[model samples]
Target: MWVFVAAVFALLYVPLFILAAFSLNDSIIVALPFRGFSFEWYSAALDDVDVREAVGNSLLVALAVVPLSVTVGTLAAFGLTRFRFRLKSAVAGLVGAPLVVSWLVMGVGALLLFSALSIPLSLKTIGAVHIMASFPLVTAIVSARLIRFDRSIEEAALDLGALPRTVLARIVLPQLIPSLVASALLVFAWSFNNFTLSFFTAGFETTFPIWVYSNVEHARALPIVNAVSTFVLGVQILLTFLVWYLLRLRPGGRSAAAPLLPGLATTERTDG
Candidate 1:
């Protein structure tokens, strides 16, 4: 089983490894025979003003999308988890519909919707589309955390004459911090790396991924593209590690999957 798992992981990561290795190859050609180790491609990628601008555009979109998506997603998760309403299940499903849909379909749908509304394709449109794409993932993570939340704690606070807002601010939000942070990081990374939505939505503006896609056809630019791709891969890996760490997989830390409220622990112990 372990061998099989290792093989699967290798299959997934081997391409990324090749991309990273080729990014450092001294040869301009990306063929098998690596001439020697060199940082020329990295320097060239860094020196390109267009690359820098694209990177900045991507960051701008991601920065805008992260807060909006996380805020909406967290609130939506709370609503789905705590409140009973007409068509609640339908609403929850709607919130997650993007996850089941193909990105290409979603991107085209968003483009058509915006076009009908007379909204021009631009960075703002890209950001909006990214928010929609990322919202489901963020909501899923936060809702999972909320499911493990101890409702009794909220009830106790209410019983002690706390207002709903007070209970949420003082009790709920604090417990949800880890999940919120993790969701934000994940959403930000996804938004930064997103290509399909950006491709349809970006008009004059080029994002990092779009820039790479546009230039990858140039054989001479392969090394520089590889370098940029490697950089993106590194950022993704770093964010993944941070999400794992923040979710308390570390030594001596409590699991994010466990109940977050102290009262719940006591209740469980007593019930057990």
Candidate 2:
């Protein structure tokens, strides 16, 4: 088992390690022994107007996706957890199935759907496509957190004279912070790294991944792609660490603690 796990980690991270190393390489073709280390590529990547536009487009897409995904996913989780509705399992599966589907298939389907609807493809259209693709994954993640939740707390909040909106906002939503934030981050990453869907839906407005792919054919722009990837990876790692630190600092510090509500259910060690 240990050997198998080690092999899996190696398979996953070896490529990442190679990319990090090549990002620092002075070679134009990202070949053998590093000729020398220089920030030249990084500088060039930063200065390129096209690279900046692509990065900005990625950020915009992620910004659009995160809120929509979170709102829809949270609502879906609430419905799944709070009410016994028909086709609940089927609904959840349909929402979450995109996580298991191939990106190519999803991309093509999205393109066809949008074309039929006459959405007039653009970066915003791609962002919308990303939201649909990502929402299911967010719903699945948030639903996992909701699964072990206790219903009595919500009832107690209602009994205590809290309005439905108040209970959701002050009681249920607070308890959902960790899971919600986690889902948001994952959705952001998905939107940011998206290639296939964006490629199809975004007919003209290029995103970072699409730009990177295009730049590969342009020999002069090769190193810039690596530089941009390095920068993005660094930013993502920093943000993830910050979120981890803040969650630990949020009045509980990893022990079993009170729920974010006075009358709500206690927060359980969710890992179990």
Candidate 3:
């Protein structure tokens, strides 16, 4: 089983490895045959004003999308998990509906919607769509964490006369820090790498992925494209590792401090 999984992963990533390797090759043509290692492509990509601008645009969109998605998604997850209301299940489904939709379809739909509203294709529209695409995943991640959370902790704090804000700030937020950070990192990576929405929405402005797509059409620029792609891939892998590390650290595990609510950890405690 492990061998089969490893083979599948190799099949998936081998092309990326080739691309990264060729990015460092001195040859302009991306064909095989050993070429001397060179960092000229990376230097060229870094020096290109267009590449720098695209990267800046992507960074701006990610910066806008991550915080908005994480904040709203976390609140929505808490509401859906802890409260009951009319059409609650329907609302949850709506929140997650984008996950099943094709990005192409979503992009086209967003384009038409914006056109109808007389909104121009720009960074704001791109960032909004990215947020919509990412928040569903955030909701799913945070919801899973909230589902397994011990609600008794909140109730105990409330019973002990702790204000709701204090309980949330001191206890709930601490427990949720892992999920929140993981979700934020995942959303940032998603926004940074997003192509379809950015492609459709970016009018005069370009993002890194869109810029790569445009430049890759020119065969001469393939090496520089590959170099930039390798850089983006490395950053994404780092973010993925951070997410994994955050999730792997068990929340509220074996800490020296006492429980948030006094006596709540005792065996005689009865609140569920």
Candidate 4:
């Protein structure tokens, strides 16, 4: 098992290592036996106005998508997990359908939907599309957290004269904070990295991924693209470490910190 895991990790890291190495090369041409090592490409990436704008666009889209997606998804998770509803399983499958559907297909579908609504394709539209694409992941993460939660505490809150809204706000939402944070980070990452969805939804302007795609066809832009990729990888790594550190700060170490909603009766396993 350890060997298999090691092999899988190696497979993943090799390509990333190659990309990182190439980003440091002084030469503009990516293919080489060994170009002199320099941080010039990184500097070039910083100086390129197009790359900066693309990065900014990606950041803006993620900022818009993460909060909206997490809020909607968390609410949906609560409804699905806390109540017995008709067609629950079917609804869940529909929510998670994006994972199975090809991004290309979804992108095309999004373009059609936007066109029907008379919404002009643009960065804002791309952000909206990202919200739709990322919401399911938030729902799934929050729902997974909810499954192990007991419902009796919420019932007790009701018995104590708390209204349903009060119970949800005071009793349920607090416990789900970890999952909420995790979902936000995941959604942001997904939105930042997404290409095909952004491709269809983004009109004249480009996000980072779209910029990278355009650069792939141009010889001069290849090294700059690599530099942009390295920056993205760095940011992602930082966010990942931040999540890890926050989890570590929780009681009972990292594993115990998962998705326990605040004010929920975790020790007693109460109803959420």
lDDT for each of the candidates? 0.82, 0.76, 0.82, 0.80
Residue pair clashes in candidate 3? none
Whole-model lDDT for model 2 versus the true structure?
Answer: 0.76
- TM-score comparison, 1 vs 3, better candidate: 3
Writing each residue's lDDT as its tens digit, candidate 2 over 96-182 gives: 676677778878898898889988898788877777777766666567667767779989989999899998788777877876776
Model 2 error, position 71 (Å): 0.4
lDDT of 1 by residue, 178-230 (tens): 87887788778778878888898887899998998899799988888999889
lDDT of 1: 0.82
* Distance from true location, Cα of 46 in model 3, Å: 0.8
The better candidate by TM-score, 1 or 2, is: 1
Superposed Cα deviation of residue 119, candidate 4 (Å): 2.5
- lDDT value for candidate 4? 0.80
Tens-place lDDT per residue, model 4, 1-272, is 99999999999898888889899888888887657899888888899999999999999999999999998888888788878889998988888787667888889899999999999999888988777777877787778779877789989999999999999899888877877886787677778888888898898989998899888989989988888898899998897676566655655676565443331112111110
Please give each candidate's TM-score.
Answer: 0.89, 0.83, 0.89, 0.86
> What is the clash tally of candidate 2?
0
* Per-candidate clash tally: 0, 0, 0, 14
- Greater TM-score among 1 and 4 belongs to 1
Model 4 clash count equals 14
Q: Give the CA lDDT, 0 to 100, for residue 224 in model 1.
A: 85
What does candidate 3's lDDT look like per residue over 94-159, in tens digits? 997887777888888999999999998899999998888778877887787788789999999999
